[model samples]
Target chain A: MLTAQSTKQFKFINIDRVALIAAAAGLLSTFAAGFVTFKPNRIAAGEAFSLAASVPLQGFLAFLALWILVALLSISGIRLEKQAVFTSICGGSLLLLTFFLAGQYATAATLEHGSISRISPGTGMWIMVFAEVVLLLNAVQRGGERTRFVTALSAATVAGFVFLLLTGHLNDISIMKEYFNRQDRFFSEFKVHLLLATSSVGAATLLGIPLGILALKKKSLDAPTFFTLNILQTIPSLALFGILIPLLAYLSARYSLIREIGVQGIGWAPAVTALTLYSILPIARNTYAGFATVDPGALDAGLGMGMTRTQLLMKVEIPIASPVILNGIRIALVQAIGLTAVAALIGAGGFGVFIFQGLGQAAVDLILLGAIPTILLAVAADGITNWCIAVIQPRGIR
Target chain B: MIELVNVTKEYPGTVAVKDLTFEVGDGEFCVLIGPSGCGKSTTLRMINRLIEATSGTLLIDGTDIRDYRPEELRRKIGYAIQSVGLFPHMTVAQNISVVPGLLKWETSRIDKRVGELLDLFGLDPSAYKGKYPRELSGGEAQRVGVARALAADPSILLMDEPFGALDPITRESLQNEFSRIQRGLKKTIVFVTHDIDEAIRLAARILIMREGELVQYDTPENILTSPGDKFVLEFIGTDRALKRLARLPVQGLMRSALSVVLSDDPGKVEKSLAENSYLWVTDNEGRLKGWLDRKVLDKAPFNMEDSIVRIRVADFAVSPDSTAKEALSKMVLAGTSSAPVVDNTDLLVGEIRLADLLEA
Candidate 1:
């Protein structure tokens, strides 16, 4: 009884660990690593600037304001639910401002030095972004999920980014300069990259979902089907591309039909095919798992209700299993986006063209020009799919 | 009417049910009961073609079962089970509307019917219709389960221990509610349960089974007085007479209660006590608060309502809807020949006595 009474009194000290970690990480990174690197030339080693030196008075004050806001929110004894929502909002704002601050610093430095000088986000900027992401993820896990508030916040963030781009606030950043130089080529390559990823995953969805259902239905086909897909997945991407080149060259060379369909030794045909093969396991396994784990009682009840087999599958089984299936699709999509860069190895055009070019020239800003957008695309896909899954799920079960 | 002739379900090696033959009369509440492995669940499923019998000439409403497509035939009958198999993704209204929707009933008609069914189960339609199955308590879920079964208003209902998973109090109350619902619907119900008390309380006719063969099919009264064999006797247990009292509702044995409102004229308590020395005390809502001893009250100030001997309903009262056996147990615990009967909300309604119950 005495212990219980003491424990009740001590309950006021419940700490929000996620907020503390995010704040601590942000503070540590600000001091340990500078916020931006100012370069004399495209390929020269740059001088890094600490947070205080990186931006002018207003920008520095703005950072201090956001930090104080976060600190206050962390220490205040608010209800966990409200605290989580506010904390995530603050995290989102902090992320946007960090990039904006770097952009402002870049523009100011370019004016002071010369047009030839370049500025890039440094390690501290990356760490701040990471911290904010951790903060946002923690909030979502704790309380912010499935609410229109979060969705609206995501929309506002996207709008803010578009506004920043349109206003040319970020123009002086080195990566944006790379983007402007190859704007036309960049757009076309971006389309090709998206198309490659989409078509392969789409084809896989068409083939793999049925295969998954079939695996569950035909017990005999289960092992061999997964085995083949597993073997396809185990082959290194480069090795698979290499193997496909020789095989496809021979087939296309020997057959008019293969040549007519553009099944060449290198390029999109093998890239897409490899990507699709990589995608099938996640989609099919998740599909199989989704259907296999439906409550037996529900199936029995559905059967007893006199639903035809097709009706049962359509109306009951599919809806219950949709979230799991979509989760698989999400995994496949993010993975496909990442691997599409590797497809550039076999002469497939994508952001990887710039990446490889940057690697050849030993230019870090040029590499960031390709790598940053690819990372953003993956993050966007994950966020969108997560929203879709949350919307599709029934409130009671979730 | 459902008729099964030589119905047997044979797995690879074992015969789950063997040569089961029976004819359930129209509108009859026939209970198929026995220990586990008695194939009662299998037999119930076979009615809906959930499990195909190895060989049988099964007829429903004077037609061979195989003549209709399995799905089409199952649509014409209502089915429920112990798990209450409500679709978690669907709301109560949608779950109940499933069969009706399959039959392509108009939307307005389906909505009205869903509301009616929800109201019939005593769940407020607006409050419960939009709720998902996971949101409901076990008893509420089972209620919705039965409501969903009756949605299409089929001529027959098949239940496999629908209330079996609930707590004892909830189970008993649900059984009473089901009995009341069954009485009104008059739908042919083939219920499967292992509880002999449940079978006795709800079933109009009982089919006793052992080792997947029919042991006896008879009325509850006959089954209680005479058993087919030692197995049936032991299955029903040794307290045959006590179990039989469960069939008699307390309301049937209840007399007009000698109850007085506490704020009523002081003279009325003494006048009411002349007929019975034990005076039941009630409040304005007709809820039993306590009882008054006439001899003790005679010397005390009549205005002393707090001085009345408090009788908690849980310790000394019986529900009007409860069985005589339940009331008898309560009466025995309270050491009284007679007990005050209350409604579900414990509003005093009448009185039942040990003598009256025994006479009945």
Candidate 2:
């Protein structure tokens, strides 16, 4: 039979868990708002505005309210609620801050018509404001029941304030609405850009890892392959794109094969190819780093125990070096996202569309439409990647 | 039984082990020992084919071990290293069950074997079965390593400096416990270490190596009494006599002349004294009390029937396993020429004298 205390502990559990639940629910709400058509009377882009404005605002505000409550509770010295509240506040706030800063640039240029970026600071704010509470809870759980609640609460409050920024929903949030209203046509284009950027990064990882392993295992292959990759990395992105344009045109004209394969210019394909080319360094470099770092003695031990070469690689070396490789992959992923945004300049479909189109039309709000999500996407990609790394690293290492 | 004939291992610059020849008899506790870089480890590793011997004919149970697949040979020969290479990801039980599990035993059988091995090593299966290697103390982890080696019941066991990292007290106790386990199991064992005392204590036949060559291979008593060369003699050093004491039992040097005194009655004398000038007094059931004053008989007719005065608990003697160095140190510190010796029941065994200790 579980006691009430135990039940409460089960509920409160880890702040990250609570933050996960809150953030997940918040993301789901955002997703729902994206799908549903809403009606806002007397709005320009009438049906589109009705479908977009209030639903995202309401969902964003709800998410914001959760973080605000978490921040307030953390500030008020309530320890029990600190972890979920603090992590949500801190982690969410940092994410929100990142989004806000990126949104400021996006809106100033008119890529968006409204302050969607400024709307919800997200769980990052809550997580940041009450980080101490989360740490305190961790300590109490580890240290035993003799610990005072106040110690944890105060610790949570203190940790939350570590990354404090006084500005919130002040200048940028107000400007956000005006920015979105001006660039109403570009929001949907931004989504496709994000999808292509992410998928291409994933595609780069798939190709890079096996090549890395082969280079590591075969010495004869290592130098030549590495030189080729180094040369590839050294080529300027703009030059690479310029080179690809002719290559793509030749393939499309000569073969009549590329069109069926979705190789259209001013579309997803070229953007993905460009972004993927930018991603190889982190993956290949990390893979090499990971394999090189495996202890020779540990390898010897496995081999001495009669492990086959393949078995040794799979069972010992790979498991031990996974974190390093993952770190490399993460770096590649971030770089890819940033570079992919540049693909929009070439009319490759993405958030880049709004920025390029806005620049052409001299509409700052349209530029904001594309640039804001790109920045937000980068932050989201980073947070999710970091979380994944944290999860993937063997508990044994820590 | 295992045999190594003319085994030599040559590396790029130097030979790691050279022309080593020895035989581990059935159920024999053979120990290989030497200072670092002496190729003792190189020799131990070669037996399991971890390192290929430059030239040798190795036999296990009178068959060439090299003929068997290395993995197959290892499966049949339990091997443990100095660092206790337990898989960090596995639980204690899982670590122990590795070899047996590798043998493809049924899950229930493997579980039973794990339980038995843990219990044999004094680790409760229920308490420690699910614990990771990091959770264990240094001593406990080493014990688990030994348990894991024994899991498949391989007739041949190889242990490489198993207790090398432990503190002296723990090392001693574990040595004794492992010796007891070995005595019961009687598995043909080849233990390796740099610690000469450990070699002497654990080995039935000790082989000393130096710079990849077999320097001396003999019984512990023979090695100490007559070292083969300057290297062997210098290795044992001036501590030869102390090392000799380690081989002898406590019964060989305990004090016998104990003066008895009464606990309840202080002044009376009708005690039995033939050639004994002193008596070791006891309260009840041979529990030690301080010795009676032998000269008190001259002053008054005193009987130590009831009254006993404990001058100090340190003044009396203890068990036989207490080493000569310890007994000698206690004697010098207590300023006593003699000390009584007793067993676990507190029954008087003998007396330890300065002369007796010096003789030892």
- Indicate which candidate wins on DockQ: 1
Supply DockQ values for each candidate: 0.56, 0.23
lDDT of 1 by residue, A1-398 (tens): 57877977875743577787788888766665568888898888889888888867776666667766766777787766677778778887887888788888889989999988989888888888888778777666666454456546655766787888889999999989888988998888888888888898999999889999999999999999999989988998888888888888899899999899998989998889889999999999999998986777777888898888898888888988889999999999999988888898898878777888889899887887778778888888898999899999866567
Chain B TM-score (model 2 vs. true structure): 0.90
Best lDDT among the predictions, by candidate number: 1
Task: Grade the docking of candidate 1.
Answer: medium
List candidate 1 stretches off by more than 4 Å. A1-35, A49-73, A76-117, A124-160, A167-169, A219-235, A253-255, B250-324, B327-360
User: Model 2 segments beyond 4 Å from truth?
Assistant: A1-74, A80-278, A284-307, A346-348, A379-395, B252-274, B293-317, B322-325, B343-350, B353-360
TM-score of decoy 1: 0.84
lDDT per residue (tens digit) for residues A1-398 in model 2: 99898887864323334434444443443334332211121122212111124334554565456545544443343354334334433443434443444334334423343433333222332233234234334434433343455345445444433333233322343223434464454556656666777787788789778778788889898898778888888888777777777777677767767777767544566667777766776787788878876656445544445556786677667876788888877787777767776776666766676677767866444566667677767877887888787877755454
Model 2 C-alpha lDDT per residue in residues B19-129, reported as the tens digit of each score? 889999999999888889999988888888888898988999998988999888887887776677776656888777767766788999999999998898899999999
Report the error of model 2 at residue B357, Å. Answer: 4.2
What lDDT score is found at residue B19 in candidate 2?
A: 87
RMSD (Å) of each candidate, 1 decimal: 5.3, 10.4
* Strongest candidate by TM-score: 1
